[model samples]
Target: MRIAIVDYGMGNLHSVTKAFEHVAGDDASIVLTDDPIEVAAADKVVFPGQGAMPDCMRHLEESGLKGAVLDAARQKPFLGICVGAQLLFDYSEEGDTPGLGVFAGEVVRFPKERMHDEAGHKLKVPHMGWNEMFIAREHPLWQGISQGERFYFVHSYHFKPSDDIAVIESAYPYRFAAAVAKDNIFAIQCHPEKSHNAGLQLLRNFVHWDGRP
Candidate 1:
C-alpha cells in the first residue's frame, strides 16, 4: 500500500510525514510529494496544512493539485489535518476564502465575546495546546482511541458542518466540531502529529482502514 501525503507548500509536511512513517513503517510506502499524479495514484491521501486559508487555497490551485486532491478525496480514503480540515468545507471566514467544498460547512472564527472560559479567563484565538475530543459518532478512526482523549490543536478558525457528519466535538469555551467523517473522508481540526500516542494510533488505524466508514 502507498500513502501520499499532499505537500501543497503550506503544510506541516516533514513532521506529518514522519508520524505516518512511524505508524505505517514498512506496511505502506509513505511519500511526501507535491506531484498531483503521485497523490492521485496513492492508496490513500493525507492532506495537511498550516497558515492562513487564502494562502492555502491559492497555493493549492497554483500548484495544480486541486483537481487531483478533489478527485482523490472523492474516490479514496482521505485524511485532512488542521487547515487541511478547514479547507474541506464550503467556505471560511478567514480571508473571506472559499474551500474545496468536500463537505457542506463553513469555517468560522471563535466569537470574541465567547473566547472566555467559564471562569472569565481569556482564551487565545488560535486554540493551541491539548484539548479533549468528545466522540459524537463512531467511525473506524476512533477505534482504540479513548473518548475524551486530548489532541494537540492550533487553530484560530473552526469548522461548523451543516451536515450531520461531525463525529467529534471540542470546545474553546463552547462546543464546536473537532472532527468530521463522511464516507471515505475523515478530517480533524487538530494536529495529530503533535498529539503523541493517541494521535499515532489514529494514523495506524487510517493506514489500515479500507474506506468503509
Candidate 2:
C-alpha cells in the first residue's frame, strides 16, 4: 500500500511514516508530501498533528492540500491522529478556529465540571500514556478489537463526534470520541503507532479494512 503522510509543516510525519513501514513492511511505501497532487494520488493518507488546531489548519490551507484531503476522505480511506482527528470535526473550542468540517461537532478541552472517577481525583490534561479502548460499535476498522482493549493516547483535547464512532465506547474520567469512521473517512484520537502491539494490530486492521461505512 502507498500511504501518504501529509507534510503540512506541523505534523509528526516521520514517526508516522516509520510506523507504517514497520507494519506494512517492504510492500508499503510511505511518502511525506506537501504536494496536493501526490497526496490526492495515494491509496491512503495519514494526517498527523503534533501541534494546535489553528496552525495545523492554516498549514493545510496554505499548502493547498485541504481540498484534496476533503476529496480523499469522501472516497478514500484517510486516518487522522491526534489533532489530525480533531481537525475532522466542524470546529474546535481549542482556538475557536474553524476546522475542515469533515464530521459534525466540535473539539474541546475536557470540561472542568466533569466528575472524577473512583477516588474522586481529577484526570489531568493531555491524557498521555496507555489507555484502554472500548469498542462503541462494530466495524471492519476495528476488525479484531474486543471490549476494553488498550491503546496509547496523548492530547489535551478530544473529539466528540455528532454520532457514535464505530467502537463500542471507551472513557477516561470523562467520555470522548476515541475513534470514528464515517464512510471513507476514518479517524482515531489515540496514536496507534505509539500504542505498541494493540496499536500495530489496529493499523493492520485499518489497512485491511474494506473502508465500508
lDDT of 1 at 179: 95
Task: After superposing candidate 1 on the true structure, give the runs of residues whose Cα lies further than 4 Å from its correct spot.
Answer: none
RMSD of 2: 1.6
> What's the lDDT for residue 118 in model 1?
88
lDDT of 1 by residue, 75-146 (tens): 999999999999999999999998999999899998888788888899888788999999999999989999
The best candidate in terms of TM-score: 1
Candidate RMSDs in Å, in order, are 0.7, 1.6
- Model 1 residue 127 distance off true place after TM-score fit, in angstroms: 0.8
lDDT of each: 0.94, 0.79
Q: Model 2 over residues 1-213: C-alpha lDDT tens digits?
A: 778888888866777777777878766777888888998888888888878889988988988989888887887778888888888899999889889888998888877767477788877776778777876767776776667888887787877777755453457786667888888777888888887777787777666555676
Which model scores highest in lDDT? Answer: 1
